[model samples]
Target: MKPKFITISDSIIKKIKSGELIPGDKIPSENELIKNYKISNTTARKTLLEIESKGWVRRIKGKGTFVLNRTATHQLVRTLGSIDSTRKGFNESLKAEGLTPKNIILEKTILNEGVSAAIVGRHVIIEGPVLKVHQLRYADDELMKDETRYISLTLCPKIDALSTEISYFKAYEQQYNLKINDIRQTLSADILEANSNKNHFGTTSNIAIFVLDSAVFADDGKVIEIEYSYYRGDKYKFAISAHPEYGHKSDD
Candidate 1:
């Protein structure tokens, strides 16, 4: 049998999906849940927390839990570390959620002056000049991601000459004959003030943000690019499937 908390959370989710529990609707209080479902207080609290973590409701201090504008606060989920998935999965997730996804190149430049052998074994795995491309990504017209890519010109000569709409991965495969092997990445969370120095998102401030630092490598064990992407926490979420080999063991 499924865990009681999961069952309760799923029931609430079903109500929300059916439009019975909608935006701004206060969900049942912990006491109400305990009374209605005959569950313990701990289970009731877990149920509510699970729902909140799923981005379905907001709990105001002493005011009960209420629904949110899912369209605005809806979390676009992207699967991470999936061998079968690519950056294309991100756009696909947005479209599946009834959102329109787009990206604009904020800047693209060459970094010849700073090309040095020292950075090869460190930040970048490639040994020559780099092309930096800064972008702002949007979903449903809301600022979602501020991304910057540093590509190895050594691996992709004249890549900067390509159109802004070209997919770098496709270019690697077709133009450079380099197949992507794996991407090493690290994800962390932080808060960004509305007046961030970058000013990437004008409408939101003091919001949660996710920082993704990654290196893209090719089949030959050479790094193709390095990237730093900041994703709006309210606009996105990440999912990953892991077997025992990759899963983190619980301390408990």
Candidate 2:
């Protein structure tokens, strides 16, 4: 049997979903919940805490709990280099959500010195000459993602000449006739902070964000590209799947 607090919490969540409870609408107070369900005051408080932790509601001192505002799930699980390596990933995700996706080229330069040289030395197959590109992604004109990519000039020299809207994966396969072997990434939750794009993203009040670091490999087991992306936590909820039986397999 489920815990009494969980059962009560489900009941409250049902009300929120059915529109019986709405955002900014006060839910039952702890005392009221105790009276309504014949549960103890402790059980009632536990129920409230459970729902709040799940992002269903918020508690204001002396003001009771109120349903939290929510929107459609904008879950992004893939990258520009899709698992299958054939799809236009980031754009497709936005279109599926009924939002127009736009990308802006903030900067694209040949990296020969400074920190770019260090990054190139560590990841790119070539000893030097990396093409670094900075891009901003938008959902219906709202800035939603910030991306920086580094490409080995020795691997795909045309990468620097491609249009801003072109997909790097397409260039790798179609233009260069090279097959992608795998894509690896690491994701973590973080806060948006002072950076070069702070003006584009505005204040750090909405601090919740996700940082993703990725590397793309070629068929010959050479690392050709590296990427860093930041997704707005307030706007996106990501869903990732794990297959333990697969046991550390790369996307084929």
Candidate 3:
């Protein structure tokens, strides 16, 4: 037999999909649901928890539970490395949602442009020439992001000669015996368009909020690669840990 909470959860999910319940709209409270569905309070509360876990709704302590204002399922944990490596991290982040990360390399080239101020002290591969690589990332085949990376071939010679079978980071290790020391990152909102042979983003084609940028440093603290990525805005959200700012103290 179906569990009482599971049945109620399904009913709520149905209403959400049917447009009867819109984003930010509050559904019946736990007490109301218990009386209306003839279920116990435990079942009512359990149903709400289920929906919240699915990221379909939010429980505002003093306010109430309401549908989530979300468009697509995009959850990213920032990590530094090659496309393959990032995909691995993405897969883990989306695992609970039953989603898998996938990608298609769109282009790879040698060029000399596109470095920004934030990465100034670090060598910009563009100052001379670099290996610029582009790829489209997907979650379970749903287009999720576009990545553009710039790597300094001057410092890591033979980098462009590496086999495509291995990840760029691993290739760097094999070719230059280098290791990652730290990573710097930034996030922002943007939009995407279907370009080249990439159309997996779907026709709706809305603006996206991307992780924006990142800089990876070799063990010696020299920047080896800088990447800028665009993510589907409707499907992405950012989470940051907060800390209180400390003010200057008087000299003792």
Candidate 4:
């Protein structure tokens, strides 16, 4: 036997599938649902929460819940130097509906010096005094994460003068005539308020999340930016693709 709330949710899902419910449409109010379905207020609220956790709708405080149209907006491509990537499983949810992703830049800044790399043999010529930029990206106003990047001053001399109105990629392309090519990435897990990120995000303490450190390269095989990003573990995930080498046998 199933719960009454699930039955109600199923009805709503069917409505969406049948075009009776449209994307971005506000769901029927709790009061209306109670009146029509003869369900309790608790049951209605719980059903909405479950739907939200399943990524079917977004609930905004002081605003009503909205049905999502996951589509092209959620598909994240896997590639090198791709600053525009999304966490795992989210793209699928987005594609399920029909929405295009929009990334907004929250902030940018400059720094005095640059940092060093851990790779051997790549150290000597890899050193350069750099410019640092900090940005908080979002998908349609929802907070995604904060990214701090160190850029080579040799390629972009006036990195400090970039306007807050544009994204770094846009600035680099339009202003400095630079395009990204390859990237090397490493990921690890950590808690909030532990190190440099704590000072940046300005949080007391929160759940654990993934820290992404990437070295971005330009089309000319030159290293351009080294970025460190922190994502909310509960909200984001990563995707990977595997390709076996030639003449390799399966371990299984």
State which candidate has the highest TM-score. 1
Candidate lDDT values, in order: 0.71, 0.68, 0.62, 0.58
After TM-score superposition, what is the CA distance of residue 68 in candidate 4 from its true location, in Å? 6.5
Q: Write the per-residue lDDT of candidate 4 for residues 1-252, one digit (tens) a residue.
A: 989888888888777667555455567778878888888999988778767777777775665676776543332223222244321122222332334343445445554455656322244123466776666654554545666777778888877675533455555666788765544666678877545545444455656767777665567777777777877665554543233121112110
Ranked candidates (lDDT, high to low): 1, 2, 3, 4
Candidate 4 wrong stretches, greater than 4 Å: 1-109, 119-128, 138-142, 193-205, 241-252
> Where is model 1 more than 4 Å wrong at Cα?
1-72, 87-97, 113-123, 243-252
**Per-residue error at 105 for model 3, in Å?**
2.4
Spell out the clash pairs found in candidate 2. none
Encode model 1's per-residue lDDT on 159-233: one tens digit a residue. Answer: 999865566766787899887776666778988887878658875547788987777677677878877789988
**lDDT (tens digit, per residue) of candidate 2 on 1-252:** 999999999988999888666444568888898899999999998999999998888776664676665655443334322443223456544553345789998889987641322232234443357888888998778778888888887888767888766767777878888767766666678866555344357654546778777777777777677777788777764434343222223432
Error of 2 at 224 (Å): 1.5
lDDT of 3 at 188: 57
Ranking by TM-score: 1, 2, 3, 4
Superposed model 2: Cα runs more than 4 Å off: 1-82, 113-126, 194-199, 204-206, 241-252
Clash totals in order: 1, 0, 3, 12
Q: Once superposed on the true structure, which residue ranges of model 3 sit more than 4 Å away at CA?
A: 1-100, 112-126, 163-166, 173-175, 192-200, 240-252
RMSD of 4: 12.5
